[model samples]
Target: MSQAPTTMKASILAPGQIAPNILSSIVVFLVALPLCMGIAIASGVPPAAGLITGVIGGIVVGAFAGSPLLVSGPAAGLAVLVFELVRDHGLVALGPVVLLAGAMQLAAGLFKVGLWFRMVAPAVIHGMLAGIGILIVASQLHVMVDAKPLAGGLQNFGALPGRIWDVVTSKQGLEAGLLGLGVIAVMIGWEKFKPAKLKLVPGALLAIILATAIAQVAQLDVARVDLPANLFGSIEFVGSSGLAMLLDPTLLGIALAFAFIASAETLLSAAAVDSMHTGPRTKYDRELCAQGIGNMLCGAAGALPMTGVIVRSAANVQAGATSRLSTILHGTWLLGFVVLLPWLLRMAPIAALAGILVFTGFKMVNPKQLKELAHFGKGTLAVFLATALMIVATDLLMGVAAGIALSLLLMALRAAYLHVSLKKDEANKTAVLRLTGSATFLNVPRLSEVLDSVPDGTTVTVDMDKLRMIDHACLVLLQDWNRTAHARGCKLVVDWQALEALSEAGSKRGRVQGLTTT
Candidate 1:
């Protein structure tokens, strides 16, 4: 919004921009490769589906993206929802549902509702991510050992101990599990102690390459990533059957949910990407629109839904990307790889990609964020934990619903909070009524009771300095009482300036005009 992002747009194909953008695109491509497949696998879809989303996200979304360096792709955050959708309605419903979701996003962006997503409680967002992370980790643990994940997040989590036991007892399972663990270790180790010279090389890419090398060297019979002979031939076009899904009310509801979550995730990621660079600030509505179009295309192709992912976006920025060319090129590279070299992809072990997701899942929990949330207050922390726990117990929608419910309850309680104390200064022949906390319609009765108990006024002073807010209801009550206070030979004293400042705008002048002041 600051500079309109025009300068960056105009220079997309500038002379010096080519090499750096290309270089950064390769870096982002390397980072995105495994994640594309892993997220799709987690979403209960094939690897090519994720690649299709990546391609659309980069080339299509990037073309219209407001944040030049931010990379969009199939995200882990939405994997749980997609998994549930796939589980409930079958894979055939996914394309239609995602298509509807994209249409909804496009409409929202047109209405300029993109900023509203930011109003979601930070605790809720983080907690939801944490919950999804837990689900991903629990489910992928089974995949790491070449086992099938259970039906639900709780089931997957509950089955962990049994899964470990199975790995210990079965030789083949043990080999796959050990290989997965080794990948995890490699990722963690590289992050902690990678040489400064090669820091730009992602740990994920290294881990996958090492995993493929190990699988080949050991001749391990683990399940590997399955890619089509020709990626273009694999696209599942939304035909007449897919379009029929629009008639189902349940699928429509799922589409709405998808749109909301995807938009929120995209805008939030764009905000984060903006902070990482000084070049151009994100125009959120534009970014949302771009994402909407991208998802629509992805849905048409029966691919996984896409959102702006922070990891790859961060990689793009750090790798010295100067324009949207980097984002577009990354998608080109992905499309090119799967088309020309599907054989190479077939060699990468599924256990290894699952391990990468496991690592990603743990990082998503982000316990360090708890400290920051704590600064807001205990209620926020409670919301965070409740959201995470509920997701583990139920599902993403329920967890988010619970968190939003709790957050609203907290707001209601705070808005109506009022503590009134009356002090009688007999020696001074006066009474002082003190107010603390917000004063709204909820507190009017208690406030009226205190005002009525002032013995018909012997110079009572209503002190509201400690009150955070005083609404019109309380203000009108005081004004009405003050009008009659003189009937007792003395006026009720009030702080007019403070009350005016605390009062809601537009009505403040009118309320303060009639209220008697000391």
Candidate 2:
């Protein structure tokens, strides 16, 4: 008998494997620290919230997560939601709401809702992420150049003309000019530099460090990060008192929204990690549990809520992280820096963080992916564009909801237009039906109407030979029809190959199978 495949462990304790993970973890730490602070600042939360999430995600979730190379932490995907929550409710009120959201996420995992994330159309997901990228760049640009009254999401576009006029007329424009130059340099380095030419260092990291040094030397009047009053601070459980605000129905609604959105984003990120792993596939349920644990720790410790971050996970994969050990090490490095090098962190420039995020935003919006979505269908492209536009205009969750509704509506319209016809033979004892075009939930009622009109005790033949698609909903309908025909003592003949072909085509057409009665 062939031996069972050995499971690969994601820890340095695995014999003879410690050095590469240690080094890779260090690189991830360098990349994550600045990002943690910047994301918190952009989300209108204290920097410590981001740091707390990063530390817990790496040390707690990373230790138990099924994907060995994936990193978990606070992400830009949640920034818009967090910002809205903080704006509507006080900052202190956010802690308990986040805690409840974490609990809901854990419950979702237990109920296997993570699998539902895969049901979302790929175009919709891509569009939502792209919109978030646009938002990140817009929000951070103000901080990069010391501009006040930072415009967010689509609001920035409206304010752009006025902002540009002000920059042209004021001395404040000088810092903006320097920040813009730094962004250009970072982008160039990322696009042109070969991995071998800078094997030991990440281009974004190098660019940020260089930009910070330049800004410090010039003593430019640029905005800089203001470290928390309590550097190297420990999060206290007293933060949980913020939960009392949830007694308000509006606050509860906001918390539920946060829970749903965070669950979707995290599960999607976990799926991406599964795609990247060369080893065993990730167990999504287990990953969800890990995320829940991490989020709870984050909230309890006064940290921003977190999810599995695709950007950070991709960075970990690129940095030669082979196991979960690297994730653990990354967290360790964060703690070390916070406790031992607070002064050094103070020296890091805000411009450097902006450059890194700008690069990240670019990566999130891939032109090639858009081209691929174009090949699927016009409706898919429309949904993608609509989602992106809505996100830029409103917020991420609303944009996604709009895209999903559009996709489903298009699917329903396509189903309603599908054609199916029935004919009777001279023998009078037999009947034949031809199905054409797609059949889905929207077509089930019409199909049933036709079946009910057929004479009793007649031989029924379902000729799906010309049918382009038949979804699970249709399949179940057909199966039920077969049962009723049999109960009436009628012969039912189904073309298995035609049915298989329809199913295959339906899958390609993006129809999801519900319950299979066959």
Candidate 3:
């Protein structure tokens, strides 16, 4: 009878969720607009394509989202992937890759494989974010100073000095640089001193609005956002020929890569956002399926691929969103802005949007987070730094692989060092071996050496009370040793209750294979 109330509570919307959702949606709308356009520009695509993805992510995914407040859109995290795809495959081939990626995500959801994505090390995920942050900051800084971004991350970084010099000495880029600086200053000031009463208004939007107003008043000679006369009239769908590219192996591989990376990022964001609120937790499979549908729409519309963006999702939660309605309404607001007010958007300076991205990228590489990882110990810090450096030097997939390999190697080394103490009680003719810490396959040599030394006709006691975990291989070794001892006419009193408990739990789930206490 009491279970009925619990089930009803899960479905019922609390009375307090309505107003907050509406207000939060409006705030998210303002923040997401500039970000969508700026990320699209950074990815070498038309700004309208970013908005197309955003509209599909919000309206389509929001309606079916597992997490109520997790916003999906044209994420900066996916910008690198998009840029690479379009660069290598051409703009025409991007649609087919994205379409195949969507199909992969749909298959992942259908198989309920969302939990497997969580197995990725936290260090790897953080490193990926930090790397992406550095990339974003490096490229956008050039755009902020009214210069074209260089081809690669290192090239962009190397050219910053010249760009700054040009902005300082020449009259060409000075006004845009000033406007970009002004927007950044406003964002910082808004965070520190904005009144509590107007907190619902996002700092990014406020900064953009104030900067645009200043530029208009002073008649600053800076490039503003350029959009089609009728923004909706500018939308173009992918060519039918994209379907033919799906048969090509290289294009198929790109599609799979896009799907895998996007899924991991979205799952990470969903998990993070779930911790920020007390609402219903996310259903990962449902969220993956929803994202699949959203990306499929993006492909069909010839837009950018989408993901669950941490920036917008965090903003949604901080703005007091309580339901999926906030995400849905935010998409509605984006649609209305494109359809009703193209002139107002064109008032925004391009440098101002770059400033917003610069600030966001800075936030992603937080010093406090690095400090926390360092505090855990040298091993953790090493993994974190290695992942971060490799990502900056190489790429996302390679960095993650390196981090996971390092983590496993460290674990094996630590396991190999586990000590198995042996004590001989001469008076009772008894031998006791105490096992401590993890018992992995790496420790088998030392364990075997110690166990085999016991004399025949002796009473050997194996104490495993302090053992943390024993792998199947090690457990099998133990069982074999027990049989050998029995055949040698020695009484082997093995205390393996810990291993028994673990095996028992596994047995209940039909997962305890190759482990036995005979």
Q: Which candidate is the best by lDDT?
A: 1
**Segments of candidate 2 deviating more than 4 angstroms:** 1-13, 149-152, 195-197, 229-240, 417-435, 438-464, 467-518
Instruction: Residues 190-306, candidate 1: write the lDDT tens digits.
Output: 999999999999999999999999999989989999889988898889999889889999889889889988888788888877776667688888888898899899999999999
Q: Kindly list the per-residue Cα lDDT of model 2 for residues 1-518, writing each as its tens digit.
A: 12233334554365556777788898888778877987887778877778878888899888888666778888887776787777767677667777777777778778877777568887887887788878877766655555543445767656767776666687565574466567657757665775785665666666667766877898766666666545545465634246666688877777677776666777777667666655667777777777777776676665788888876776676666678898998998887777776666566666566656666676677667777888998889999999988988877668988999999998878765668798987377898988888777888889989888788788888887667777788888887778777778776789755685577554554444444422
Error (Å) of candidate 1 at residue 21 is 0.9
Among the numbered candidates, top TM-score falls to: 1
Ranking by TM-score: 1, 3, 2
TM-score of structure candidate 3? 0.82
Question: What is the Cα-based TM-score of model 2?
Answer: 0.79
lDDT to native, each model: 0.88, 0.74, 0.80
Clashes of each: 0, 0, 0
After superposition, which runs of candidate 3 have C-alpha atoms over 4 Å from their true positions?
1-17, 411-417, 420-434, 438-464, 467-518
- Give the clashing pairs for model 3: none
Query: Which window of ten consecutive residues has the lowest lDDT sum in model 1?
Result: 1-10
lDDT of 3 by residue, 1-518 (tens): 01111111223558876787788898999889988888887787878888878888889999988776889999887787687677777888877788778878988898999778777777767777777778888888988877888766778889898888877777668888888888889889998999999876778888888889988999988888887767667666666677898888978877887898788889999988876766688899988889888888888777889999877988887777767888999999998888788888889898898898888788877767778888877787788778767766776567667888998987778765667998988777898989888777888898899888887777888787777667776888888888878788777786566575544354454443444432
